[model samples]
Target: ATLPGEQLFEQFTKGLELVFGDKPSLGFICGIKEAVREDGATLPGLCCIDAPYQLDEDYWGSEYQCEVDDGLGSLIPNPCERISPYFGKISEESCKVYGGTYCPLTDCTRLQECVAELIDIARNENRTAFANYLLNAPNITDPENSFQCGWAREYFGFPANFINDNQICEDIKQFRNSRDFEFLEEFFNQGSSSDEPGDDDDNFNVVPPLVLVPPDPENRDATEAVSKKAEVQNGQAWRATNFALESAAKTLNSIYDAIKDSKCPCGGPFCVAGDICKLVQNIAQKITVVGLILIETSAEISKFTYGEVAELGNVEPIQTGERVKAIYDNMVLTGNYLQRRFQGVNDYLERMENRLVRALAPPSAPGPAPETVASPSNPNITFVVRNGVGCDGLDQDGDSVEDNCEEDRFPPSLRLTSKASTSFVCEVDYCLEERFRTQTEAITFLNAVFDVVDDCSAPEFVQKVIEQIPGTVCEKTRFEIIPVQTFPENSTCADVTLPGISAIVELGLDTSAPTVLCGFQVDRSDDDRRVSPDSKTLVIPSERKSSFVDTLLFQTTADNCPGPLRRMVTVQSNEFVYGTNSVVLINQENTEDGSVVPRLFVNPQSCADGSQDDATICDPDPVSDFRFYEVKISVTDAVGNEAVDTCRVIVEPSRRRNLAKQTKDSQRSSSESGKGSKKIIPIEELLLKVAESNVRYTLATVTSEVSPSPVA
Candidate 1:
């Protein structure tokens, strides 16, 4: 349901008015509602209206004749007088709300005097002094804080009700009462200074430096010491990322210079063919800009971390922790990625320079040997050489052994691989124990490292500019461990005590994405239980049904990273039937004929098998003169949520048994032959005879029989 065009315009005008002010004019926008004269007479539609207005009450709204210049270059006279009082008019107060200085004509005497003093004060005084003066002025009421006005009351202070409710006072109060008052104050105080000291050209266009404001202690739930330490760590991470960007910038500039120096026109000794030089130059420029944009993105991301970092100490912390952790992780990962890219480009340029030198060298002498630029390796990571990896000739690990060679001496370890086949073995022994802890602080430091072995390098440049360095194929195994209860919360021998009775459930996981390796650590009061070899499935004997409740702990490897242990609870009951909703009567005999019929129970067949000697009742004495028993069935999910339904079972005699009892008469008597007992031939068969005489006789006999009944 969408609002009509007029209604939508009215609502939008109302909201805009709340943000700015009613009756404030700026070009097309006039008053929030329809314009009216001083006598309360409504003005005509848009074309006839005079929209320009002033604060002075003597300036009564009026209508004026007008003409519009159509785009086709002809002046068309308006059909009606324009009565709107705000077209093309600008409001000084609205301009101030938008952070623009508004200068009005001196001829507007009343408004000039009214706002002249405040305008002078704003220009002469600093923001703090002006805000203080507004807040503490006499005859001015403090701003209201009522929440009924929505964000207007929350983000901005209520307008001060000064003498006569001057509009300027409200704007001042809003500034003083805003949540961003401190930021605005800092902007006004320090943002005005010249970029280079002692040189003042009034370059007000310069954006202010980013200021990090520590959140309130109440929000963070941290001691003063811990808060200070977190701040220090935050600053350090930022500086390190900034330094990486700076180095990247320098490398891009150097690359750009080298490309420019190598460029030459065609037919020259050093000339490069085609657009290769132009292409390389373009790539260098794009990469430089990309680095710059990343730096800006890093700054923007830092701002989002304030509230997220504070949310770490909240009782429910996973979502916030993941968000903040991603920031730190991305920073580190991007730093490493940039380092790899810069190094690759530098190595390419060095080789090109050496090639040029060889080309210019004397033909009698051989070219110098190319330098072997080894790939940089992280200290936190270990490497292993394996067989049948990519690019058989290259030694990626610098071990002088090709990755495809089978006789590698390195030991097998957990390897983290990227989409590009860049593999490294990361041994973070502590991450396994602490990664899944509910406490965000447990993994904060490690998450900040970014280089912590994970699948962070899955995204790669698709363009040819990205070097296609041959990398080793990574061989690593990862699995997710899930603990599953083999039975319901409360169950007897029928559920799991029987052989081959184990609860199987799907956890609704993406089985195709990650391998699931399941195992369990069971803790139960009963000793009479059996566990599967993998420790994932548990079974308890019928005798130990009463105490089969167990807690199972599980651990898993989260693809290229360490995950924490998870716990699941399993329960069993001594009772054969877990619950009974109600007793229902099912007649065992047909009411009309007193015929007996047998019915089967819907519950587990074992519950009705009396030979098992379980608590489940099959046929009980008449309850209210009806012989019946209750059959209960229940289903539970992997997470222990359950639904149960029950029905009554009635017992009766079998109808088949009654029908089998009827005996057959064995005696038989001989009978004498008679005309009435003789078989009679049909008239139609007699008519089919081939002889004409016999056919006529049969027809005559049929006609006589019919005539005897009636002459029809």
Candidate 2:
């Protein structure tokens, strides 16, 4: 019913499905067959089985004998003649040409032999049982068994080669190249050898009528030797695989250990293990430095007393020396830590290299030697030294040895003295042969030296000496008293003006001994005059006077002076006192109000005594003989002590004129009385009219009588 090609296609599709689990689509099966054909291979053949309809023993016996004779006669000329006669005969011509008898009977005989051997192999715990079963049953083409053959063919492509070889023994050599042979070889190597046949065996007594002899012993022994060699090679391969796996694991562990011990390049506190620790420390250090600078600068600006004169700019609050020190400390810590971490990383890297070398090389070969690693002990991280100022006392030759450690040398001791005035002297004991780069720098260095001393000194003596120095030292050397002013119980100059009050401080440079003074001067005006009479004159030692004067002149005030009185003081001889030449001048002409009345004045005539050329204005007594006629009154409140009132006496001539007119009108009315009922205007009304009339007259006289036209 079907064409040869069509029938072949159908049989191939059915056979593939039975062997490989499921039937693919017709097109897919056709494609697979086409692919096989393209590669010079043929699809597997399929066969069907049908049961015998009826069996007559006598008849079957005769027919079977005839078939056996027919098959034997057909195989008589074949090279495998020894086993051919065992096949039952079929049509003589069909058997001879197509060998149907040998094809079917040989396959059945092989299956029986394989099954028996497999049972024996299994009972003996032989791993080669499965391999031997496949080998012996090579012609069993039942679909179930064929499916396993197909699986092995697809997996290793060996059974396909065996089939292509037309079942020849030579094909086994080609099939052995497949990966399946490796499994087969491993299985066979682990199996026990087959037992030798004995004369006592009953199976040997009943021989088949047609028997097939086994292969030659020489060929069998050669095959067995090849199998043994493969087994030995497989064991060596497994050992190599294990060695590679272990070496890789060791290398990975070494790398992990190195990373764990390695330090971070950016340093602070080692917080590598904790999350974001390095970032937090970095931010904290930056904030601390910035906060210190801001606080110090604010303190310096608060020293000014007067609201007007203190408005001068360039008064910074931070102590430059302290700021530099803070920066230096942070940098040192960071740099030192980084150096250490770098060393550790380098060491780790070397160890990692060694591990890699060992992994790649043989165990007997020596590994490359590890390199020596080093870390910096002290990385001198310092601030930018400006013009020989704020040197950290480490410059030996005054050459600004900020970058190099070789040039660094300790500075000499600085001595400071506070006098009765509000200014102090800072003296350097070092040789003057090493000249300062600039006068400003010299002043700054000296002031900083004093500040360092003051910061570490006793609290009682700190304020007395610190208050002597004016605020205007160098920008980098100014020391500010925090919170503007503080009142400690044991202060010596509590009642004195703000300019005279000293602040006690420690420079924080050293903990061993007091080395310098950080003096603060209250008065900033050029016209230096003592605010208090009881204040004493301040003096500096002749040698250190220049440093004291320079620092005093540069310090500025926060607010300008409000009233005529200017507070002035100086520090000298370890004391804070009022300045000698300070003057309080009134500048009310520049006030917002147009009034020219002098708010404050010192009468030269009143103050003059026969003793001194300069007149002294002492505290005035309200009940004194001094006249208050021209003096304008200024009232100040107690709380802020700020001026709250301004009072001036004004004599009105218009009121006098109105009074005269009212008197004249009252007299005239009295004389005209009794004759007519007098019109009596109330005294208040009369006074109002007279006042209005006088004002109008005054305006007219000024406009028309004094100047015919308004003055340009």
Best by TM-score: 1
Backbone clash total, candidate 2: 52
Q: Candidate 2 lDDT, tens digit per residue, 571-621? A: 111111122221122323334643222222111111111111233333222
TM-scores of all predicted structures: 0.18, 0.15
In candidate 2, how many Å is residue 44 off? 52
lDDT of each: 0.29, 0.26
For model 1, how does the per-residue alpha-carbon lDDT over 1-712 read when each residue is reduced to its tens digit? 1111122122223322222221111110122222211111111112122333311233344322244456599755534322212211123332222232232211112222333455466535444423433332332122222222222211122121111122333344444433233323433343444556554332232332222333455755454445444443344434544555555455545544544454322211222221222332344344344444544556456445533343332222122223344354334333333444446545655654444333223334454532343433322222222111212222333333332222122222222223112223333121121112112331232223222111111112000111111221112121121111122223221132111111111111111112123344545433333344455443322211212122132322122222211212122111133233111212245668543222222221122223222443433222121122232323222222223333222211122112212211111111332212322222233222212221110000000000001112
Error of 1 at 105 (Å): 61
Off by over 4 Å in 1: 1-225, 230-242, 267-272, 299-326, 336-712
For lDDT, the strongest prediction is 1
